[model samples]
Target: MMIKNTAIIDIGSNSIKTFVIDQEEKYSKIVGFDKSMSNGFDGNKINNFDTFVDSIKNSINKAQKQSSSKVKNIILITPTSKNKNHLISEVIELNGAQIEDNHLRQLNKSMIIKYKTKLTHCFKSHYVIDNKIITDSPIGINCGSLSLNAIATIISDEEIKLFKNIFSKIGLNLIFIYDSSIIYYLYLKSLNLHKKNIVFIDIGSSTTKILTIKDEKISLLKTLPIGSMNITNDLMTLNISKDFAEKIKTKNIDLILNDHSSVEIPVWEELGKNQKQTKSYEFIQSIVTARVDEIFKLVLSSIPKSKFFYSYLVTGGGSMQLNLIPYVKSKFGIELELVEPKQVKGIPTFWNNPSIMLPFCLNSLIENGYIDKFNLFKKNDSFSNKIWYKRFVDLL
Candidate 1:
């Protein structure tokens, strides 16, 4: 059987991860994986661009060494640090002529120009044609005028420049750039979950993203600055290294109360001295629980009360916490489901880690033809066609 190779680069707030996958007709195998910490930037801008670029270069090189194929095209996924959403409406007069794809494209282009923001993704809610509402495309239908309602997610231009420069430096072409939340939404929708009014919570090291899907469409996307890292930082007050604190956070710890139970935590002192500290399990749990509670509270407050979601799904590294599911349920009065890459068939067991879920989803989408390959590199020509062409050529 013949195989094709593709690569995915996921730059999150806490880390930069790269994956190389080989896909046949029916299955995909992860051939390479490389990850590097972001030096505490966690998706935010840092003063040292060269250091950040070097980190990305090292990660890509490691993954390349593990793969057999040369990685030419890359799908880049980045978290939305200061993401903004707008419900934009655009109308175009048809003058009793049939609507065409170009007409709809023009309308979309106009909206993009009007917003004047770097758009990450846009989903059309519905189209109004001659007073008739349609969820699908209204192409080839005679209408006096057509109006479209869409939700657009926007990110900072500076962030895009940073990633583009990093990729250019590494001699890789960016075929697709997506907001991490959008990628997660696409992955969940692919699972055939078929749940209406679903809420997705993705917890990362330094941030958490919340997205709501209504009628199988993304209704909201939000990111909060607080994430699992906050809990780890809280544990650092015990004089433990961040690395050790992270290990404790993910070590099947329980949030339930056991007042009399205690666990001994070991730490390294100066001069290579070994020190053992005894602390009540309750104390550690209390520190973690407090931060988690704040995270959930902020999530709840950000979501509008009028919106009703029947199902809630949590994913990402932070969601791997042993008691996160039950704790979220008890605190928010909503049952939460943990999403795992294992749920998707044909993915190797070793590649089931949540940290690589974004790249895995991108691979699946590309292999299944859900997302067009060539179209991934195209830019919107709404404002100026010439400018779009120039930009496209420049990327080449």
Candidate 2:
């Protein structure tokens, strides 16, 4: 048997995580994992590009060393802080009853031209036929010319340039660049959630991404900028130190603090509760609960009500909150489940906890050949036509 190693690096607003796995036909436990927090690129321009690149490179380098495997191919999931919107287009065309590569190419060409976008990856796009849903690549089957419907998750060109520059600095070729939400969809597929109408939620430090899968294909997606970090900020503003605020935020106390408390906050704490309890456990919970509720509301409004399904499958560092799961369930009237990324095949079982290892599962899915990439654009005519190329060479 041959041993293959695949590495996936997810760069997000909160932290940068790397997952390295040994790949066979079926992925096994994770072999290597690395995570670095406090990159601090949220809600502001990333000024230290060099430091950021070094941070990304160091994560992969550390994972490779710990996992003791050589990487063959790298799948990159880029940051989605700039914008999140749905770009939908419907095309009705007829090319006889037989569909082949030419038809696909022609349709892809026209789409790229009209949208002014380019294809960089290959992913599944489904269409509604008759009353049932069908995938586009149903070749050698009987059908009309075709009515194609597509919903694309697009990241701006400015973001792509940032990604290219980061990868270029590390001297690694970017085989594919996909939104983190797509990577999450690939992760969901590994868990058998892809076949059903599932809402997969990735609650990170700075943003929460909601991706909807209906009829086994991506149907809708929405992202919220608020995340677990907001809870910390809430505590910090109450004049509590970072260390103590984090502790109080997670600790469960019998005392119930209301939304409107007159607790005065101090810069630091004296180990135990003082007379002036500026930040009470109840207060923190209220703030967290309210913000999380607002986040979910925003997500709910963006997607169709029918797509909510039974519940939301949640993951990411924020999922660790014990109160969050129950709160979300009762408030939204939806079942909530946390994704254990380590349990997935291809990811090493050494670190199976979701508190900090959610990205590892995403990495494993990409390595195990479960994730699909969408090509945003086709190669333009200038690249294929020799005459245009020759003219450009002469000018150079």
Best by lDDT, which number?
Answer: 1
Off by over 4 Å in 2: 1-6, 22-30, 69-74, 83-117, 135-142, 145-155, 189-196, 214-219, 251-279, 306-310, 344-351, 355-358, 372-396
For candidate 1, the TM-score is 0.79
- The true-structure Cα RMSD of candidate 1 reads 4.8
TM-score for all models, in order of appearance: 0.79, 0.71
lDDT of 1 by residue, 1-396 (tens): 223555677877678877776777866676777777765344666657777777777777787788788876666776555656666678998899988899877876777677533455665555778766545569878889898776566656555565666677878766456667666766665566758678788888888889887766667788888889899889989988888888788773677645457767777677867778888888888898898889888877877754345587778888877677877777778888877665444334654677666677777766665444212113451212454335545554
lDDT of 2 by residue, 234-347 (tens): 877876776565555555421233444444455555775563545554656677676677777877776786534535778877776666666766787777877765465433
Question: How far out, in Å, is residue 13 in model 2?
Answer: 2.4
Model 1 accuracy (lDDT, Cα)? 0.70
Q: In model 2, where is the ten-residue run with the lowest total lDDT?
A: 375-384
Clashes of each: 2, 19
